[model samples]
Target: MDCGIILPSVSPNSNYFSVHASPRSPCIMVRCQQKEGQVKNNHHYNELPLLKRKRPTMINIPVDRSLENNNIMNTSRVRVQEVEVEEDGYGVYSKKGISRTRLEDRYSANFASDAHGKSKQALFGIFDGHGGAKAAEFAAAKLGNIILDYLRRGDKSMIEENIKNGYLAADEEFLKGNATGGVCCVTALVQHGSLIVSNVGDCRAVISKAGVAEPLTNDHNPSREDEKLRIESKGGYVDCCNGVWRIQGSLAVSRAIGDQHLKQWVTAEPDTQILTIKPDFQFLILASDGLWNKVSNQEAVDVIQPFFTAGSNKPELKNACRKLVELSISRGSNDDTSVMVVQLDKFAH
Candidate 1:
């Protein structure tokens, strides 16, 4: 990662400010465990009837540049495509927020099982940085590749364990740096028809299955009952300030990638969920808190559903992704916003 700080350098007369963030400015740390001893059953996902497979090939989605002429796409910042990773099974899109906050969000997606000479597998992740972009940036640049390399080593049974180790590796690597900041993250890994979703902090992953919306991860906010219990059990305290629940009246989340100062409280652990990819699964959504803070899960599904059903390609999907981010800004999200849309079963039928 480059050590140079990327500050806003847009021309004064320009209407837009170029946006940039990378592992260049993020932090890393992790501590995960599966909560057990709970007998209560959570409501199951809404399943949809499978329709006949009769659609044409889905279009190739690309980065949406509709805002290029807007006040946020100035020449001072490198284009989003410079960091986007798109291919056959997935597409990722990210942009700077309308806020003056550093462009501290980062994302990654990879779907090349052949490269590893194994059964098909895909990995996707999104990180939202705070303090600096170091944690998010570091995870974005290294996490998925680490998992992929681990898988290539022919040890696939302990998927959750392997992923946790990967997060730990990222955390250890980031702690070695001099940067001071942290990042929240969410990841979706699909292999052998199984989908595993893992997350820390508020960034989220939602899936649209047969027109119904299903959230894959929970936000680790300080106020969440379970999160609060976990923090207090660890000898930490939570407080409410100005309508927001914060850890020790400072951080808003209970878990994150990096925060050396709060390492004892703000854990790096991620909650994990596993499920088989059903035929009804339509698309998967991953995004930073900026978009979720302004949009509801159902609302997002409603806005992006039509595009998927219409056999949308790369550019169309890119537009859909861009539309969601723009919507967040319009809805008053002053934080950096990033979104990724992965059309499941895109190669099917």
Candidate 2:
């Protein structure tokens, strides 16, 4: 699985700040040193869609720790549905959840290549759509491109600033139709042996380094103390329904890309995390709430690590992804689910 790039996997320096946690909610928040009476809205956050009470009950699914030591061939319950993926220094896979009739989840993988077909840079993401799929569908196709355009400017100083602008631009562009619905997003960008992760809402990103799960994004649920305070400060209220805290008694997440009607409270700005790919950074798991709600971070990592470590040839990330989706379904994930497994060929060497 060597792609000619190997990096250190731990001791990451945290440089990511979001409008959501700060002023709060995005790779999109822009803080300013303003005087009294002046406010800056650099964070391109928006309110969420107000609908009937929607809370997916969180179910604790116990992981069989012994499964981690077994070979993939021995795992009879898991099937190998390996998609014929075009490899450019990475292996990837994703699937729709078992609960939804109309799959609203969407994702994308973009690799910047040279003439010989080797990849120099890559971007991957997972988007969980609620209300409808249009917003999720739109962001999957556009966010990466927007960021790439910014990088082409050759201004490392503005990399973060530009990426934030990209989210804002995407949000602005989508709102042109005054469209309905919202999407939670988690994205990873790999370049110069560094991984930049940005997220909004409950969709998450986690990297398994040295066989340990290191979380890269925060789940922006209304129940989180920080989130509750932010919403309250805005004169909004958080209430528990069916055992889940929701903003304004309707939306479950505090930040998202759309939800035009709830813009005042729910934001689109994503929190960001930057990590230099370490030697032990094996792979990354990016998924929607359905998977996260059902699978604990360590459980998810422990399940997949054995596959990469024991296999003779490179472990198929697609198979690992499929097994994870299956795990979530078996664990009672009652919403649309999506997962992407990224084999960090560069780091695993």
Candidate with the greatest TM-score versus the true structure: 1
Model 1 over residues 220-248: C-alpha lDDT tens digits?
Answer: 99999998998899998999999999998
Model 1 worst lDDT run, 10 consecutive residues: 67-76
- Point out where model 1 deviates above 4 Å: 1-87, 115-119, 152-155, 311-315, 347-349
Residue 184 displacement in candidate 1 (angstroms) = 0.6
Give the C-alpha miss distance for residue 182 in model 1, angstroms: 0.7
- Judging by lDDT against the true structure, name the best candidate: 1
lDDT of 2 by residue, 1-349 (tens): 2222212121123222222222222222233233333223323323321222224444322121121111111111232222223243344344445454455776777667769866677878788888877788778778778777777874786666767777777777777868899889888888878888988899999889889998999999998999999999998999999998888888999988888888889887778887888878888988888889999999889888887889544776666777787898888877766667787765322
Candidate 2 wrongly placed segments (more than 4 Å): 1-95, 114-117, 346-349
Model 1, global lDDT: 0.72
